[model samples]
Target: MTTTRSLVVPLPDTTATCQARRRLDELVKPVGSLGRLEELAAWLCGAHGTVPPRPLDDVRVAVFAGDHGVSAAPPGAPGVSAYPRELTAAMVRVFQAGTSGVTVLAREVGARVRVLDIAVDAELDDVARDVVARKVRRGSGAIDVEDALTPGEAEQAFSVGRAVADEEVDAGADLLIPGDMGIGNSTVAAALVGASLGLPAHRVVGTGTGVDETGHAHKVAVVERALHRVEGRVADPFDRLTALGSACAAATAGFLVQAAVRSTPVVLDGVFSLAAALVARDIAPDAARWWLAGHRSTEPAQSVALTALGLEPILDLGLRLGEGSGAVQAVPVLRAARAVLADMGSLADLT
Candidate 1:
């Protein structure tokens, strides 16, 4: 498959960022008093190429849904996911009904939600008419034994993501949030992060979806085996993604790259999204400029990925849910930062 080098992502303008900082310093409040809020506003100025960045009025969250072949493990299997693969399709329905955590939070933040069925295994019934139907395959192959997708399939998944990002941008979405909802995705995410950072599985794996102690141990072992299979072979980001073997993650990474190409800011959620971000960064180093770590997840790999990317989470609520819940929670903070920059009077005006 071709790498993302062909895609041109513009770097944030440092001159505009400096101007934004200067303007913030002149606000009525004390210099640096707003803490991270001031920093976020300046970063927005750099991203949007405006001294006073526009408010994130039209935020959109795109939740990519898929299934993992590993999720089909037998009942007595050692490394089976806690939830059934059927939940992947069921949750997509929930998202469409506007009753899922992501929908509720999107409503609270005034952001629109789009559920993209990138590669769910089962045929979904009663799905909303608007859900993007870009299924690459029934699901990804088992990563522990074989590559998740052939080179062509991997590229197709990336195209699905890029198309979705383009569509959203065309619809006037200024800010983007990428989310994941696939059974066994956390296991795939842990393996991807562990392999990319050269960390052991025990260090990066976490108890996903309330797995028991035995299930957690099994998960770690599964990750270990998968990483061992792909170790020393993941010379590039695309290789790492194929090694990890997740369609949803590949799509999310693609979406992230496309959003950055469009100069749209992204708030990434949890380990799955962070794992994709790691791959996206490898594909396009400057893509990191348009992303913010929405929240720190309980999963250990999240910290590893965020630290490697030089991003600090805006919120740390011990959130482990992956339906973009944590990222949506941080939207208000971005809004508040933009509001401060746009609405606050200058010290000269106050005097």
Candidate 2:
């Protein structure tokens, strides 16, 4: 005869639990002591919400494209407004053509690309039936003098992103990839990232589209001035986003919140995506846990944002292009993680 006693033990920290087991195995001889690979495997387990995460059925990429008003002020031939507005439409075509490196790579992995027109300047014609249409505004206001977007516009963008994520989750997408395609968008990302870290633009800014030294310097100065302008203001996530963010950033932040609530993973690309992730995390801390930094970008603010969030990038290919390319690159790594847990032989089986 046996008697059972009622007892409760709190669950171990998911992150630690997964890591400890892998580290223990790696400590053994022969198969063990393979450097940090084992440690990394364990970390992946926690990020996947499993002692050993397995293959997900479907992977989808959501690219949120928009334009920036600051482009209007750039001292140049085409002018800021002329450049971003037309380029936004062209990039959308590149995405639609399935010719972009990101689109092609994702297709190779059987991942679907869902392009969302969060705030592009041009109208998309003959779009693939699959792309998501969610334009909030044509472009943002110049940050050199005024707020990027009104509070109401920011809220609307967020709402659209949430709705898209909810709909995708309902359609069986377990993981989401949020990318952006907007000219002069990096300026907006720099502003938001700078504000979050309380750093001036000179530190957070980076070259976009191979800018000349003078133009690059000018961009940095713009970021610095924007930071000073917003000083002592409300640091609230939504407020901060509206005042300084591109439509793409605002929308991605909202999508991240929905991803957390749905327990779906988000693969983030570049500085803008990282900034949006940070803002979304502020809205919902659990969302940070759901994020996987797909890669490090050439942008300086990206590393800072990743560091502040305590996230390690899955890949460090130094990718600066932000068409969801990084996310597509990480899909294989995620799949490999699932394979290790689900298919790798147990010690007993090997014996």
The numbered model that scores best in lDDT is: 1
lDDT of 2 at 34: 40
Clashing pairs in 2: 71-80
| Candidate 2 to truth, TM | 0.87
The whole-model lDDT of each prediction reads: 0.87, 0.74
What number of clashing residue pairs does each candidate have, in the order they appear? 0, 1
Candidate 1: what lDDT?
0.87
The CA-based lDDT of model 2 is what? 0.74
Over the stretch 1-351, how does candidate 2's per-residue lDDT look in tens digits?
A: 000111111222486545646644633244654444454456556655566654666888888888788776534543322244467778888888888878998888888887888777766657654443577777788887888887688778887778788888899886788878888877888889999888888878888665767678878877777788888783888788877887788888888777766667778888888988878877766667667788888889998999999988889997888888887888787776555555566565455
